[model samples]
Target: MATVQFKGIVKKFGDNLVLNGVDVDIKDHEFVVIVGPSGCGKTTLLRMLAGLEEITDGEILIDNLLVNELHPSKREIAMVFQDYALYPHMTVEENMNFALRLRKMDKAEIASRVAEASNVLQLNKFLKRMPKQLSGGQRQRVAIGRAIVRKPKVFLFDEPLSNLDAKLREEMRVEIAKLYQRLNATIIYVTHDQVEAMTLAGRIVIMNHGIVQQVGSPIEVYRKPCNLFVAGFIGSPTMNFMTGKLALEGEALFFKNEDIKLSIPPYLLSDAKKHDGREVVLGVRPDDVLVERDGEKCSDKVQGVLEVCELLGHRENLYLKVGGMRVLATVEAFFNRSPGSAVTLCFNYKNMHVFDKATESRISE
Candidate 1:
């Protein structure tokens, strides 16, 4: 186990800058996930840490030791690549022990390490199997096994499950979680999938355009996003955003847009009068959009026409049109409402978010 640190990390490819002044501290035995969209430099950062990419300016410290100029083989870190970089001709056992063999380790010691990793990954039966003979999930497990045999201070996974089907990915996620518990090793995972970040990470590092957006537990990021991008990126089904302006009317602050108007709760923004006539964006999740049902009315409910209903087993998604704006609401299965039906919906203020339009930063508590 080891603590990893990136201090003022920067990378450049000739005239193009990929990462700029990125800083993150990963604690010993922590499962930290770096996640963002494509071309965000998440993988590039990981490669820098692994010595696969050069650092234009900055320091990488592993276990409190400066490793900026250290060779990748001396970093004491094993990386599981996105494509499951296994030797095509080598058997699983051969691939797992290749590093040890390169070091000219004792035969008995190499065999013991291989056996231990095989048992941990349940790959004993596939030890003699070649990479092409195994399934996608099995090959990924072998790649991980190769890393495990090294007993490195840190484990880096670069989207190791992206090549698998959804069902296999789910199963591998559980396997990796269990492996973490058994090893209690420092793990850094990189992926573009927010679901993977939210479910597997002890702490998530959200990055965009080479800048770190937020670092916190999944619940912390989900419940209280720092800005508009964090608010929109970390959740499922995406959050619905309504752009408008805030106007102080008699003591209450109201948000007015072309499609609808909503009163901002005092607790959400205490100094309401100070933000009078300010452009802002209101954010609400699909699950937080309350729809009128069972003859019950919602506070500040606005009328809309249901445009579509998508049934997703245990839940249903309602697409509604209010004026010219579109809104999505996730509700219990069998909403029993057909398209074109008139529906009234309101936001759950407890989970509402308000952002300053100019800075794209959250303004509400």
Candidate 2:
């Protein structure tokens, strides 16, 4: 296990900047997942750390040793690629021990490592099977086993679960989590899946447009996003955002848009006088949008027309139209409401997020 640090790292391909002035400190035995949409530089950052991509500027350190000039093979890292990258002709056992074989390690020691990795990955039954004979999840386990045999100082996983089907992905997720507990090695994983990042990471690094947007534990990012981008990206069903202007109504502050008007609780936004007439965006997650049902008394309910109700097992998604703007409220299932039905909804102020529209930064305390 080793600590890894990136100090002002940058990557450029000709004139296009792929990564820009990124910095992060990964502690020994920590699992950090870099997550972002495609073309957002998460994978490029991982490649730079693994010594696979050149750093146009800045330094990378492994256990406090500068490794920007080191070769990939000398970086003491193992990478599990998205495609599995198994040699087709080789059996599972052969593929797992290929790296040790390349280094001309003792045949007995190589066998020992292979045996231990296979046991950890539950690949004993498929040891003699070729890559083509194994299932997708099984092949992924083999890829991971190959990495385990290297016993690298740092492990890099680049979307290793992306190729698997949804069910396989979920199962493999549990396996990987178990692997981390057993090895406890420093890991840096890159993925576009927020679900993976949320579930696997000790901390998550979110990137967009070649810049690191925010870094935090899963719950921190989910509960308190730093800006508009993160607020909209980290949650399922996405957050519902309403564009409006803050208004001063005597002692109170209110948010008024063409579609809706609601009081802005002082506990959410302080210094109400300063925010008067400020253009802001109000954000609430689907789960936080409380749609009134069965005469439940909800404070500050605003009326809207139900446009659609999507039943998703135990939860239902209600797409509604409040004047010209749309608001989505996720509620308990069996809503049994038809389209065009009138509904009343309000936000759970405790979880509401207010962002300055001009800067796209969170303004609520």
Candidate 3:
């Protein structure tokens, strides 16, 4: 397996700048997931690496060697697309071994390689099945098995599971993770699903508007987002942003917006202290809010009326209207809660996320 790097990569489609000076490095043998909303250039980046798209400007390095001009087949990489792209007339084993046969590899060598790949993807039982005869997950596995048979130095997955049903997508995600472990190959997977990015990636690269927003581990990026785009993009329920003004009340700092005035947790005050009286954005995740009478460690409390309540078995999501702002809070699944009741809630000081009102960048020490 080889490490991959993109330096100052840029792409444009007839004046629409798609990738803007993007730079990223994928460690050897690492499973890196690139996530962004549609048309954020995530797939464009992958296509550039695969030599499928011509990058307008930049360097692409595989194993520290410049490969911007390298042909797709010469780059020592295999790509699996969202579509299975299987041969309708060929059996699973034939599809898996087609590339080798084209390269004129010995028949015995091709058979051994195909058998090994089938075992890795658990497709041994489906070797005789044609594309139309197998299920979606099985066909996807066959796609992966074909890639593995080639022993490519790097693997690229372009939303390969998008074609599967939700349940099958989740199952295939685990299967893909296991395949990565068995092969130990560098992988670049592009997906819009945050759940897949969070679960499969060793590192998550979040992009927006053709620019890279942030790159960090799933937890790090989730807890400490680089900018407003990332804070809003990477999580399931999405972090809540309240427009507010940063103010100094005596020796302490607080952000007051609309009817809510929240103190900047002391530990985080260091960054906002100098900019007292300036405006800033307050961010908090739904999971960080606690129900009434929940704790004593909360920094502030709000009295809100639940406008909508959803029971999720493991937890309940309460959508409340605190003045003009709509706040979503998650409570224990067993907690008895209903709409129209007024409830007091608190949030931990350490859980608050603050951003610069002007630049929208996170105010982190």
TM-score winner among the candidates?
Answer: 1
Model 3, C-alpha of 98: deviation from truth (Å): 1.5
Worst 10 residues of 2 by lDDT: 292-301
Q: Can you rank all candidates by lDDT, best first? A: 1, 2, 3
lDDT of 2 at 89: 99
Per-residue alpha-carbon lDDT of candidate 3 for residues 177-234, written as tens digits (9 for 90 to 100): 8888878889999999999999999999998888989999999999899888898987
Error of 3 at 313 (Å): 0.7
* Candidate 2 residue runs with Cα over 4 Å from true position: 293-299
Q: Which model is ahead, 1 or 2, in terms of lDDT?
A: 1
Q: Which residue pairs overlap in candidate 1's backbone?
A: none
C-alpha positional error of residue 9 in candidate 1 after TM-score superposition, expressed in Å: 0.7
**lDDT at 36 for candidate 3?**
95
Model 1 TM-score is: 0.98
**TM per candidate:** 0.98, 0.97, 0.97
The local lDDT score (0 to 100) that residue 287 gets in candidate 1 is 90
- Weakest 10 consecutive residues of candidate 3 by summed lDDT: 264-273
Q: Provide the overall lDDT of each model, using Cα atoms, as 2-decimal numbers.
A: 0.93, 0.92, 0.88
- State each model's C-alpha RMSD to the native: 1.6, 1.6, 1.3
Number of the candidate with higher lDDT, 1 or 3: 1
